[model samples]
Target: MHGTETIPVRRVRDGALDLLKWLALLSMVLDHLRYVGLSLDGLYVPGRLAFPWFCLAIAANLQRVRGAPVTGQWRYLGWLLLFSVISEVPYRLFIEDADTLNVLPTLALGLLVARGWQQKTLFDRGLALIALLLAALFSSNLMFGFFGVLLPLAMLLVFSRPWYFSVLPGLVCVAANQWQVLLDSGNLVALLGLATCLIAPLAGRVLLRYAQGASPPAMRRWAYALYPLHFLLLLLVRQIIA
Candidate 1:
């Protein structure tokens, strides 16, 4: 009991976060479908929405810890860390030429950074600093690189500020992707993908504010399994069609 704290339970459900999770999951699947032997390159644009939305959801969960115990925070980090490892095999099997690791590690590190900022404790700060340094050092090997690590921190900064300030982080989100190269290519789909990356976080913020009252399916701990399982399911589909 000396070093442990009780994690506070939420009394009300946040439909917005649930909806965002579902949307992010859908976007990810759509993006991956392009590889399942179909002409679904068009899915790329919607897929741009996935990462940003997931980042926002992470921020939202961290935001709820204001003035509360950081008890459950460890579990949150643990779950991400576990799935990050669990998801690697399936992710590699599904995405050909995936030189980088899966996206979950980035999210896990980002969570630590956000918690470090919010908690402002020595341990938290040290952990966040280490994560930041590691992300910077291995930017090429990480899924979203340094910008991905920073996105969650940016979202945390935007969470409590004026709504209009979401644009700053939105820019960071877009930069996380290859927007400049896409613009240089002058491809319509790439251009749209860039726009979606820029807009995804802003759209998620709007939903969090205006759709708070809506009742959506809650994405609980069980949802962690979805990350790896989806890849396997798609792989089966790919094998079947082949």
Candidate 2:
């Protein structure tokens, strides 16, 4: 009798990617706490890591879906768009002095650019071009500005190319931030913030490539609720503390 063979199945969900998402979420929360009736000025340095890590996560997801059905990609963009609208009021309420719109819009645009580059479809390219033009027109009005939309594309490029090529996008990430002010301050926290912003993508890439042993809970569609809900929760906390 021939014996039946069992092949080991690879995991569909990546623990390292989930961990990166959790880190980004936590960093964003800590960053927002600075405005939530706390003396958390020191949180700024860690906050610098949030956006780049989120962009890296997007790049990782895009790479994962490279040869899969395009519907998943559209669904991802739909979620970002929905949350971008839903989170705005809560974001504004939570951050009184906020000048630009919420971060989700930037992420959505970034997704378009990354997808366009990956699929190279005429429709995708057209959408990306429109997003780029919109980003340029509203550079000052978008959270993280235009470079924010480009950061994910840069990260996608980094993932598809050699490792050392990450620095180019790292510089772009730094430029998206308030680096000049940090440099002008010339403090340890400021320097650390600059370093974190520049190295976030590289660190995320390393984690994605080597941290397969980790099995953290995967962040899924429900994670979208966290964005607006976090702001509401923080608002309640602030009210209670007050």
Candidate 3:
């Protein structure tokens, strides 16, 4: 009965994680849809859902792993590295004027930072430092890739603390949204991005509550592939329509 009871809890968590992930993916697709079909000036608004949702997912995983044996945690990092390579070229080809490094690289590095902070390991500490430096140098071309690296850490902080403390990540997310930079375009989309980043996490916390369950193997396995695949598919659609 104990084992059986645990299964339901695990299913609930995994189900919730998968649900939030799919929602984030859909938001990202809609955001990218602007690149292909609509070009709605406000398209970036919903697109804001992608990064923070991904960050919360990472934090949720970390929380799940909190007491688990840490020996094989690096395996997760390895999988991320594998997909980052797979995703890079397709990502570059799909987005016009996109920076060289893609989101997976940032997510990969962010995972290292979060895991390192958890273990307090010397190797991870060094790696985290190197990752931060690389993110800073590549920031301009990567288009907020560095901010993406910081995002997991931000999520971890918020997850570790109370609701009132959420202001910390909220500020970082807003700053990273580059409101001042967007001021030049004079487009309201930037403001929309800011609002989404601020509010999304609050909703995310609630969504995360239900993320308990069995391993989301199918969803987890497919998600990394979808990152690059979606971009390429959207690019094809855009070309055909054009």
Candidate 4:
């Protein structure tokens, strides 16, 4: 356990959280479908929902774990780091000339910061500082850059606030996407993507707050494997279509 204070000492799995994750994963797959040799640039806008929603999940998870003593936080980080490495090969193969590592690393680092904010212990806080320093130093090598690293914390800050307050993380999401050139192109999808990023946190928060009884299947750790698996599946789709 190593006393990471992450997992719930007493909380039950929230169906709402799992539903949010399912939606995030779906958005991610839609985003990656662009690589299947199709003209799905429009998917880019919805894909914009993926990262921010995922950040919200991390934030929500942190909030869920608050007040729990002596958690399996280390195990959560372990799974993220493991997948961050495992997913790299498929990620690079799928995304042509990918300049940054896959999204898991960004999520992993973001988890550190978000959990640090929630936990507030010396070790966790120190780790969070190191994570921030690393994120700043290696923003270019990260899939979503420095802004993405800060998003989970941004989400955490606004999670319990009014819906309109989501704009804080919304700005962070847009920065992570870095789509000003796309916005200049007059693409409706690009414009929609902007709108989606702006409202994703609000949507997710609403989902969790009101849809607690939705009964979605829990997205357990095994779901991590889906990130890499989907890339390979998309590659296969490209080959079939080619």
Maximum-lDDT candidate: 2
Model 4 TM-score (2 dp): 0.92
List the candidate 3 regions with Cα displacement exceeding 4 Å: 1-13, 184-186, 210-218
In the range 24-68, model 1's lDDT, one tens digit per residue, is: 999999999999998888899999988988999989998886677
Candidate 2 lDDT tens digits, 1-242? 34787777865888889988998999999988888787988899899889999999999999998998899899999999999999999999988888999999999999998899999989999999999999999999898899999999999987978778889779989989977988999999889888988888888888888888888887989999999999999999999998
Query: All models: lDDT?
Result: 0.89, 0.91, 0.76, 0.89
Q: What's the CA error at residue 183 for candidate 2, in Å?
A: 1.8
Poorest 10 consecutive residues of model 2 by lDDT?
Answer: 1-10
Better of 3 and 4 by lDDT: 4
**TM per prediction:** 0.94, 0.93, 0.85, 0.92
Cα error, candidate 3, residue 95 (Å):
0.8
Candidate 4, residue 114: CA error in Å?
1.2
Q: What local lDDT does model 1 show for residue 195? A: 88
The window of 10 residues in a row where model 3 has the poorest summed lDDT is 4-13
lDDT of 4 by residue, 1-242 (tens): 67776865655789988999999999999999988899988888789889998999989887876776635667778999999999999998899779999999999999999888888889989999999999999999998899999999999999899889988998888888776865897778878888888888888899999989988887988899999999999988999999
C-alpha RMSD between model 2 and the true structure: 3.0
lDDT of 3 by residue, 13-84 (tens): 467777778878888888888888655757788888787888778877887787777755677778788998
Candidate 2 clash pair list: none
**Candidate 4 lDDT trough over 10 residues, lowest sum:** 64-73
